[model samples]
Target: MTRIVLLGGGVGGSMVSNQLARQLKPEILRGEVEITVINESDTHVYQPYFLYMAFDQAVPADAKRPERAVLNNQIKLVVGHAERVDREAKDVVMGDGAHIPYDYLVIATGSRPAPETVPGLVEGGHIFYTEEGALKLRDALAEFTGGRVLVTVGVPHKCPVAPVEFTLMVRDWLDTHGFESSEVLYTYPIGRLHSLEPVAAWATEIFDQRRIDSRTFFNVETVDSEKKTVTTLEGDTVSYDLLVAIPPHLGQDIVKRSGLGDAGNWIATDRHSLLMQGTDNIYVLGDATNLPISKAGSTAHFQADVVSSNLVNRIHGGLGSVRYDGKVFCFIEAGNDEATYVKFDYQHPPKPQPPTEMIHLYKLAFNKMYWLSAAGIL
Candidate 1:
């Protein structure tokens, strides 16, 4: 039997496994193939909702579902932490010392925020990346009256557009929640408001129109919790009554332990094939790859199509000629119930459209329809 093992239960892994199961239903029924997903958690959380959760617009229940429910019944689900991937032996070593062998491997372990890397950041600033972080930020917002709200961004974080969306939404929130006196100051590590040139230009226009203050080339060095201030590597200190930070992210520890990734734990992957470099049977996707692209859910969904098709074709003695075109789409919330969207591929740059209430409503609908997406029906 051809055994395929997926080493994570995130969006990419779940989608690919489900797609493969659907496409290879005949092979599986004949005892020709098997698919297994090894994940550390029994629950699958839609992380995008954490942004809304911080603003009290969503709850934890809105973001979470049983991992088994999100996956296909035919796929085996293993809930345990992985120790390391044994590439030479072609198996995954579990923390409990179990060896799961595979004819093919898919690494989708995703990424994690490293707030502790920045001194005093864990104690001084608020982050909405995780469920706990979002709930804490929600409590902080509830108690806040009015002050200088600073939003500092770090490099290589997931959900590239979240910081911008949060800034815009918070500005509107302050106005509607009797905190109109609050000042919002945004900062970026690079020399622009955003990494994408077009996005930077678009966000700059919105910031100016909304009277939001911003600074570029501000690399956070440390935070002084007692003083309520942040110091930048450029030798400048800024005071804030409240601080929201998008912390730097790194790949899974198992990737590093297995020596399958760089110092930052990002695995080298073929852009078109989505396969790990120097390997034919191993594929990498989502935030695990070092590809120079936004680590967003849409990217994972797009890559899933390529990987699943290739895997299915290869199992049928095909050359697996399908290639990923680096397609990505993102909804940019512009506040006041208006939103915009940007769609681009490897050869094209995104041009964000004008904000509209209809687009905002579509984004809300998409949130509710995300379960269908996870089920590989959309």
Candidate 2:
């Protein structure tokens, strides 16, 4: 029997397991293959919904579901933390001292915001990446009357356009709440509003129209909670009454501890094959990998298909022909009621698309489809 073990039961992990379960059904039913997924939490969170949850547009309860409920019954689920990967022995070291053996290993543990990299960031700024953070920010936003509102981005953050979306949403919220005196300012580490050229061009016009001050090349160095001040690496400083910061992101600690990560603590994999750089039996997906693409859920969704096909081919003693082309699709919210769509791949860059209420509706529909399909309820 082939023991296939998946680490991290997040979006990418769940999707890969679902596809693998279907592809290897014959072997699974005959007891020739066994699949197990290990995750730290018992609940699966719909992270994208957290944005709406912040504004009270979506309930918190609707954003989470039991992890087991979303997975196939045939796949074994283990609730534990992954300590390290023992590639030499083909085993996964669990936090509780158990070694889970595997013939094939899949690393899908995604990245998380690392606020520790910037001194005083966690103490001073409000971040909206998690449920608790978003909820806290919601209260902060409600209590805010009028002052400088700053939204700063840490480079290479997940969902590249999210900071821009948040800036737009906050502007609308201030306008609706009669806080016309409040000023909204945005800053990026790089020298552009967005990494994608076309999207940046579109965003420039939008920022101008909204009168949102955007400062580029302002890499954060430290934040002072006492004075509510942000200092950039080049010695530029900005003060704010309310600060929304996107902290630097890093991969799972286990990946780096296992010596499987690059200098930035991300798994180095072939951009096309999604296979670990130095190992044949190990594969990586989602934000954990050091791929030159946006670390969005859509990227993981597209990569899941490629990884699944490659795994099947390897299992059958054949080299996989399928390759990932760095495909990514994003829906950028203009405000509360309108959004824009951008699609691109390695061969092509994003082209500008006008924001529309219909695209916003499509985004709402996608949120529903994501939960339904992930739980196999649709």
Q: Rate the local accuracy (lDDT) of all candidates.
A: 0.94, 0.88
Question: What TM-score does structure 1 among the candidates reach?
Answer: 0.99
Candidate 1 stretches with Cα past 4 Å from truth are: none
RMSD of each: 0.7, 1.3
Give Cα distance to truth, residue 369, candidate 2, Å. Answer: 0.8
| Model 2 Cα lDDT, one tens digit per residue, 140-248 | 9878878999988896689888888889888888888898778999988888888898988898999898778889998999999999999999899899999999888
- Weakest 10 consecutive residues of candidate 1 by summed lDDT: 368-377
Model 1, 34-144: lDDT tens per residue? 999999999988998998999999999999999999998889999999999999999999999999999999999999999999999999999999999999999999999
Residue pairs with clashing backbones, model 2? none
